[model samples]
Target: MLAAQRRDLLLARLRQDQRVVAKDVAAELDVSEDTIRRDLRDLAAAGLCQRVYGGALPASPAVADYPTRRGVGVASKQRVAAAAAALIQPGTTVVVDGGTTALAVIQVLPTTLAATVVTHSPTVAAALAQHPAVEVYLLGGRLFKHSVVTCGAAAVEAAQAVNADVFLLGVTGVHPDAGLTTGDADEAAMKRALARRSADTYVLASAEKIGAASRFTVLPITAVAGIVTDAPADDDTVRRLTEADIPIIHA
Candidate 1:
């Protein structure tokens, strides 16, 4: 196929599947993996896709909006969220990061628990507001249009001031070596600040995020006290994390 036709085909597949693997494209198009990689690089350069370790995802999924993302992995996120929320104790301060998974955690919070929730996510703050016993503190900063989360220096500073019992961090990608990373650099920075200010930090991830890497690094896996994921506890991935001394709570 011609270069233009090949690029169009690749983009169409990405739109349909939300991701594209180089090997799959190369085999389908009868081209070398290098050719597929070059196509992906060009697409990424044009801001049409975000290249990942072995594939590429749509530059920004349509559900990049907080409310939309909240519905994407509703079941998995709820399971993970319930597990994370169970760790919260009454009258303790908690920091929730911005992600659909974290929003799920807020949704399942008990109505009777008394606590303060500091967050950069407007969606999370809105969810927590429904609980009469919880105090929601929404940080101020530049809003990220796609995620609808406040980020930047102001948000980071606000996160640093609150000493919380736990910080439930949402990760874009978590690998054994790459640790934690996010698509947005500012969000990663804010998460790091939240981790540093909290007494304990727990990462919430889905099975797909494991073994993945993103653009910006947040912290090493060892930095977190625990991880809550939808993957099986005894899976090789979870076992590796457990061996590192970080407790794994499989939902």
Candidate 2:
């Protein structure tokens, strides 16, 4: 087949499967792996897909700006939020990450609950203003406008002084093989720093994040305490996570 025909077929496969392995696509197309690689490279350049280690994912899965994401997965995020908020026991210090999902967790937190909540998101800090019993500490750093979170030396340094009972992490993608990933490198570093200071860390993800991969990896799947998602236990991504022995909490 012509190069154009091959590329078109590959895109179709990517749309259907959300991912396409180089070796598998090459075999199906009866083409050399080199040819498939070139097609993938061209597609990535055109912003049609994203190139990963052994395959390609449909565009970038790192997510859009905060407002856009807040509207993307409302129900799933709310479910995940409720489940995450349940993990926070009264009087314990908790580190909350920034994201719509993380904000949702803050929203669902019990009004009567008493705890110390530390976060890098100004939005999260403001949300806790009405919670009389909750102590709020906002980590300071250079503001990242896209996600509306703080990152940089100041944020990482501040995280060092915090020792929390639990860290509620929010990410753009979660995959058993790719691990937990986000859109920005600095944000990933900040998250790693928080995870190190926490007794346990749990990822809050919607179904769209499952099986997806992003630009920067925060932690390996094993490093996290467990995953809380809206995807069913029987979903393919959940099965993959379970097979890896990572705990899955269906929200």
Candidate 3:
């Protein structure tokens, strides 16, 4: 096929699957892997995809701002949040990440339950103000506006001090091969630090994040205790994670 035709077809596959492997696309199009690579590079230059080592991911994931993210996949996030909330018990000290989904976890938490909540997001800390039994600790640091969370040395040091029972982690992507990832380096560092301080870490992932990848690696998928998501066990991404013996809680 012509270069333009092949590129269009590749874009369509990426739209449907959210990713396109170069070798797979080459075979499907009856073309060479070099041709597929060129097509992907062109697509990336056109701002349609983000080129990865062996594939390309939809560009939206690479630059999804906080507000846009808060509005996408609402129901899926709610289900994930519900499952994550159930993991928390009374008197548990939880390290809640700052994000819309994490906020949903705060909303679903029983008011009667007492817990210590540590976080770097001022917004998350404020949301817990109405919880009469919860103690809130807001980590001080340089604020990162994209996700509206704190980062840098102060945040990392503060996270080290908190002895949390569990960390309700959020991420931009989760892949069996790529592990847990986020869009920014500082946020990844802060998340890693928090995970180290917690006894157990559970990632709250929406279906969109499953099988996806991002620029910065937060932690290996095995580093986390488990994943709480709404994806079915039969799904390809979920199956891969399960095969790796990574526990998945389907909501």
Q: Highest TM-score among the candidates is held by which one?
A: 2
Query: What is the per-residue lDDT of model 2 for residues 114-188, given as tens digits with 9 covering 90 to 100?
Result: 999999999999999999789999999999999999999999999999999999999888876678888889999
Best by lDDT: 2
Winner of 1 and 3 under lDDT: 3
Model 1 alpha-carbon miss at residue 64, Å: 4.3
Candidate 2 residue 50 Cα shift, in angstroms, is: 3.2
Q: Provide the lDDT at 120 for model 2.
A: 95
> Between 1 and 2, whose lDDT is larger?
2
> TM-score, each model?
0.76, 0.93, 0.91
Error at 241, model 3, angstroms:
0.9
lDDT of 1 at 153: 88
- Candidate 3 at residue 77, lDDT? 90
The TM-score that candidate 2 achieves is 0.93
Q: How far is candidate 2 from the true structure (C-alpha RMSD, Å)?
A: 1.9
Candidate 3: regions farther than 4 A off: 12-19, 27-32, 45-48, 57-63
Task: Write down the RMSD of all candidates, one decimal each.
Answer: 4.9, 1.9, 2.2
lDDT per residue as tens, model 1, 1-251: 89899899888886565568899889887899999889889988886766878777655332245666665667877888889999889989998888888878888888899988888888888887779899988988999877778889888877767888999998766666557777778878888888888999999887656545567789998888888888777655567777887778888
Query: In model 1, which runs have C-alpha deviations exceeding 4 angstroms?
Result: 1-68
- Candidates arranged by lDDT, highest first: 2, 3, 1
